[model samples]
Target: MEREIVVIATSNTHKLDEIKEILSDFQFDIKSMSEVGLGGLEIIEDGSTFEENAMIKAKTVMNKTGYASIADDSGLEVDAINKAPGIYSARFAGENATDAQNNEKLLNLIANVPEDLRTGRFICAIAMVFPNGESIITRGTCEGSIGFEPTGNGGFGYDPLFIVPEYNKTFGEIPAEIKNKISHRANALNELKSSLKVYLERI
Candidate 1:
C-alpha cells in the first residue's frame, strides 16, 4: 500500500520524532520541512497567540511546497506571572537564547514564590493545512507547576522545570512513552487525527 506524504513544518528534531511516534499508527509517510527541502526557510512568528503562530507556520509551508503541512506552536504559561512567557516562551531570555537560558530566567523569576502557588501549564496549538487551502486547527494543554530548579536529563525546552502532579515528576524525568501519552502536543495531535482522516479522504 502506498503511504500518503505529510509534511511537518519545523526543524526541531525532538518535536519531529515525538510527532512521528504519536502518529505512527497512521499509514502516512511523515517528512519534516528539512526533509522536504524547505529547511532554510524562516517564517517569522509575530502572531499574538499559539494558534496564530501555528497557522502562520502551517500556511507558509503549505504555500511554499504546495503540499499538506502540519505545524505546532507551544509554550509554558505560569499563573504566578499572569501567564507570562506565553507566546514568548521560545525567546524568553532573548531572541537567540538557548533552552538553558530560558529555563534559568524562569526559575529566577519565580524563585521566591511558594511551592503551592507555583502553578503553571504547557499550552500547544497545532495547524494542518492542505494544498487546497483548507485548514484545521486544534489546541491542547497540560496542567502542572514550575519547580524551584531544573531536574532530570530528558525531554527538551521547559520540560526540566514543568512538574506533572499526578506523576510527581517533571516532564524531563517522565519516560518517553508516558510523556508522549500526556503531553500537550499529544493532546493536540489526538484531536488532529480525526480531522486529518476526513481531510485525507477528501483529498
Candidate 2:
C-alpha cells in the first residue's frame, strides 16, 4: 500500500530536515509545502501565542491541500528578559534578520545578567490539522541558560547560545543523535507520534 502523504507546513529547509528525520519511522510520506505544489501559500502569524500560530499554519495548509498538515511555532524564552522574543523570536532583531543578528540582539539585551540568572527555555508548539477538521496540538520545552557567547557551529539560530547545564554543552555542540531526543521539537513530535499511531491505525 502507498504511504499517506502528510504535509509539513514550513519553508525552512533546516526545520524540514529535522522534522523529517524525527518522523522517518512513521508509515507516511512526509513532504514540504513546496514539494506539494503550495509553495506560494503564506499565512500571517498574527496569533499572540505559539499554539495559535502553529494551528493557523497547520490549518491553512490542510485546507489548501485537503491533507493532514503539521506546523510548529518555536522560540526561546529568556527569564531575565521577561520571556521576551517568545513569538517574535524569528524577527527579534528585525524583520528578515539573520540568525547571528538575533543571537547578537539577545546577548546584548542580557549582557548584564549574571550566569545563574540567564535561565530560559526553548519552547515548541506543534499542531496538526487533518482533512476532516480534526486537529491535535502539543507543546514541549527544554530548560537551559543562555551562554555569554556563541559556542559550537552545529545547530542553527539560538542553538549555539543555549547551554544545557546537564550536558555542559549547547545544542550546537551536541550531536544530532542526542539533540533529536531532548529538543523541544523532538519532545512535541514524540507526543504527536503517539497520537498519530491511533490515527494511522484507523486508516
Give, for candidate 2, the lowest lDDT window spanning 10 residues: 194-203
Candidate 2 lDDT score at position 6: 91
Steric clashes per prediction: 0, 0
TM-score each candidate: 0.94, 0.94
Model 2 clash pairs are none
* Cα lDDT tens digits for candidate 1, 117-187: 99999999999988887899999999999998898999988999999999999999999889988999999
List of clashing residue pairs for candidate 1: none
lDDT of 2 at 62: 92
Residue runs of model 2 more than 4 Å from their true location after superposition: 201-203
Quick one: best lDDT, which candidate?
Answer: 2
Q: How far is candidate 2 from the true structure (C-alpha RMSD, Å)?
A: 1.5
Off by over 4 Å in 1: 201-203
